[model samples]
Target: MTQQTENRTPERGTHVYDPATCRVGEFQGKVGPHAMLRPVGGGREWQADPGKIRRATAPERLRAGVKAANERAGRML
Candidate 1:
Protein backbone atom coordinates (compact mmCIF):
# COMPACT_ATOMS: atom_id res chain seq x y z
CA MET A 1 0.00 0.00 0.00
CA THR A 2 1.11 3.54 -0.67
CA GLN A 3 0.32 6.55 1.45
CA GLN A 4 0.82 10.26 1.07
CA THR A 5 0.87 12.90 3.73
CA GLU A 6 1.31 16.67 3.79
CA ASN A 7 3.68 18.49 6.03
CA ARG A 8 1.98 21.14 8.16
CA THR A 9 4.88 22.60 10.03
CA PRO A 10 4.35 26.12 11.35
CA GLU A 11 6.88 28.45 9.79
CA ARG A 12 8.63 30.51 12.39
CA GLY A 13 9.00 34.25 11.83
CA THR A 14 8.08 33.80 8.25
CA HIS A 15 6.94 36.54 5.93
CA VAL A 16 3.20 36.91 5.58
CA TYR A 17 1.91 37.84 2.15
CA ASP A 18 -0.41 40.82 1.80
CA PRO A 19 -2.12 41.16 -1.55
CA ALA A 20 -3.25 44.71 -0.90
CA THR A 21 0.22 46.29 -0.78
CA CYS A 22 1.85 43.65 -2.88
CA ARG A 23 4.39 43.28 -0.11
CA VAL A 24 5.38 40.73 2.51
CA GLY A 25 5.07 41.72 6.15
CA GLU A 26 7.66 40.08 8.34
CA PHE A 27 7.79 39.65 12.10
CA GLN A 28 4.05 40.04 12.15
CA GLY A 29 2.28 41.20 15.35
CA LYS A 30 5.57 42.12 17.01
CA VAL A 31 7.10 45.59 16.89
CA GLY A 32 10.43 47.25 17.69
CA PRO A 33 13.25 46.33 15.38
CA HIS A 34 13.15 43.07 13.40
CA ALA A 35 9.80 44.22 12.04
CA MET A 36 9.99 44.58 8.28
CA LEU A 37 7.87 44.86 5.14
CA ARG A 38 9.44 44.28 1.76
CA PRO A 39 7.83 45.24 -1.50
CA VAL A 40 7.88 42.69 -4.27
CA GLY A 41 9.35 44.86 -7.03
CA GLY A 42 11.70 47.54 -8.29
CA GLY A 43 14.58 46.25 -6.16
CA ARG A 44 13.29 48.28 -3.23
CA GLU A 45 12.54 46.81 0.19
CA TRP A 46 12.15 47.64 3.89
CA GLN A 47 13.70 45.87 6.84
CA ALA A 48 14.08 46.28 10.56
CA ASP A 49 17.58 46.27 11.97
CA PRO A 50 17.21 45.98 15.72
CA GLY A 51 14.09 43.88 16.05
CA LYS A 52 13.44 40.30 16.97
CA ILE A 53 13.12 39.46 13.32
CA ARG A 54 16.80 40.29 12.87
CA ARG A 55 17.59 37.87 15.62
CA ALA A 56 15.10 35.33 14.37
CA THR A 57 16.50 31.82 14.33
CA ALA A 58 15.43 31.27 10.73
CA PRO A 59 15.88 34.66 9.17
CA GLU A 60 17.57 33.52 5.95
CA ARG A 61 15.12 30.71 5.23
CA LEU A 62 12.14 32.88 6.06
CA ARG A 63 13.33 35.62 3.75
CA ALA A 64 13.88 33.15 0.95
CA GLY A 65 10.39 31.73 1.36
CA VAL A 66 8.96 35.22 1.29
CA LYS A 67 10.81 36.02 -1.89
CA ALA A 68 9.64 32.83 -3.54
CA ALA A 69 6.02 33.40 -2.58
CA ASN A 70 6.21 36.95 -3.88
CA GLU A 71 7.56 35.77 -7.20
CA ARG A 72 4.92 33.04 -7.45
CA ALA A 73 2.28 35.69 -6.77
CA GLY A 74 3.89 37.97 -9.37
CA ARG A 75 4.92 40.51 -6.78
CA MET A 76 8.28 42.17 -5.98
CA LEU A 77 9.35 41.08 -2.52
Candidate 2:
Protein backbone atom coordinates (compact mmCIF):
# COMPACT_ATOMS: atom_id res chain seq x y z
CA MET A 1 0.00 0.00 0.00
CA THR A 2 1.10 3.54 -0.62
CA GLN A 3 1.89 5.96 2.22
CA GLN A 4 -1.34 7.81 1.55
CA THR A 5 -3.44 4.65 1.84
CA GLU A 6 -1.78 3.63 5.07
CA ASN A 7 -2.80 6.87 6.76
CA ARG A 8 -6.37 6.85 5.46
CA THR A 9 -7.74 3.91 7.42
CA PRO A 10 -9.56 4.65 10.69
CA GLU A 11 -9.71 2.34 13.68
CA ARG A 12 -12.32 -0.41 13.77
CA GLY A 13 -15.88 0.54 14.85
CA THR A 14 -15.51 4.00 13.38
CA HIS A 15 -18.14 5.35 11.03
CA VAL A 16 -17.05 6.36 7.54
CA TYR A 17 -18.53 7.68 4.36
CA ASP A 18 -17.81 6.12 0.98
CA PRO A 19 -17.96 8.93 -1.52
CA ALA A 20 -17.74 6.60 -4.49
CA THR A 21 -20.85 4.76 -3.40
CA CYS A 22 -22.35 7.66 -1.48
CA ARG A 23 -23.06 5.41 1.48
CA VAL A 24 -22.21 5.39 5.16
CA GLY A 25 -20.97 2.37 7.08
CA GLU A 26 -19.07 1.31 10.15
CA PHE A 27 -15.45 0.33 9.73
CA GLN A 28 -15.49 -3.18 11.05
CA GLY A 29 -11.95 -4.22 10.29
CA LYS A 30 -9.46 -4.76 7.46
CA VAL A 31 -9.20 -7.47 4.89
CA GLY A 32 -6.00 -7.38 2.89
CA PRO A 33 -5.59 -3.71 1.92
CA HIS A 34 -9.33 -3.04 1.92
CA ALA A 35 -11.35 -1.96 4.93
CA MET A 36 -14.49 -3.94 5.65
CA LEU A 37 -17.59 -1.86 6.29
CA ARG A 38 -21.03 -2.91 7.41
CA PRO A 39 -24.17 -0.94 6.80
CA VAL A 40 -25.93 0.84 9.66
CA GLY A 41 -28.66 -1.73 10.06
CA GLY A 42 -26.14 -4.55 9.90
CA GLY A 43 -26.13 -6.68 6.77
CA ARG A 44 -23.63 -8.08 4.35
CA GLU A 45 -20.39 -6.11 4.58
CA TRP A 46 -18.45 -4.56 1.73
CA GLN A 47 -14.76 -4.00 1.24
CA ALA A 48 -13.67 -0.52 0.30
CA ASP A 49 -10.30 1.01 -0.32
CA PRO A 50 -9.48 3.15 2.71
CA GLY A 51 -8.10 5.91 0.54
CA LYS A 52 -11.65 6.61 -0.61
CA ILE A 53 -13.26 6.71 2.83
CA ARG A 54 -13.59 9.62 5.21
CA ARG A 55 -14.74 9.71 8.81
CA ALA A 56 -18.46 10.34 9.12
CA THR A 57 -19.55 13.64 10.52
CA ALA A 58 -21.52 13.96 13.77
CA PRO A 59 -24.79 14.29 11.88
CA GLU A 60 -24.04 11.18 9.91
CA ARG A 61 -23.57 9.21 13.10
CA LEU A 62 -26.85 10.47 14.51
CA ARG A 63 -28.66 9.46 11.34
CA ALA A 64 -27.06 6.03 11.41
CA GLY A 65 -28.18 5.51 15.00
CA VAL A 66 -31.71 6.50 14.08
CA LYS A 67 -31.68 4.05 11.22
CA ALA A 68 -30.44 1.27 13.45
CA ALA A 69 -33.11 2.07 16.00
CA ASN A 70 -35.87 1.87 13.40
CA GLU A 71 -34.53 -1.40 12.11
CA ARG A 72 -34.49 -2.81 15.61
CA ALA A 73 -38.07 -1.70 16.18
CA GLY A 74 -39.17 -3.54 13.07
CA ARG A 75 -37.62 -6.72 14.39
CA MET A 76 -39.87 -6.57 17.46
CA LEU A 77 -43.10 -6.53 15.47
Give candidate 1's error at residue 41 in angstroms: 17
Assess each prediction's global lDDT (C-alpha) against the native: 0.41, 0.81
Candidate 1 per-residue C-alpha lDDT over 1-77 given as tens digits, one digit per residue, 9 for 90 to 100: 11111322224445444333434444333244333455433244554432122222355446756766778787533
Candidate 2 Cα errors over 4 Å, as ranges: 1-6
**Candidate 2: Cα lDDT at 76:** 100
* Strongest candidate by TM-score: 2
Per residue, candidate 2 scores C-alpha lDDT tens digits across 3-67 of 22457557778888877777789899888888899998788899887877888888888888898
| Collision count for each candidate, in order | 6, 0
lDDT against true structure, model 2 = 0.81
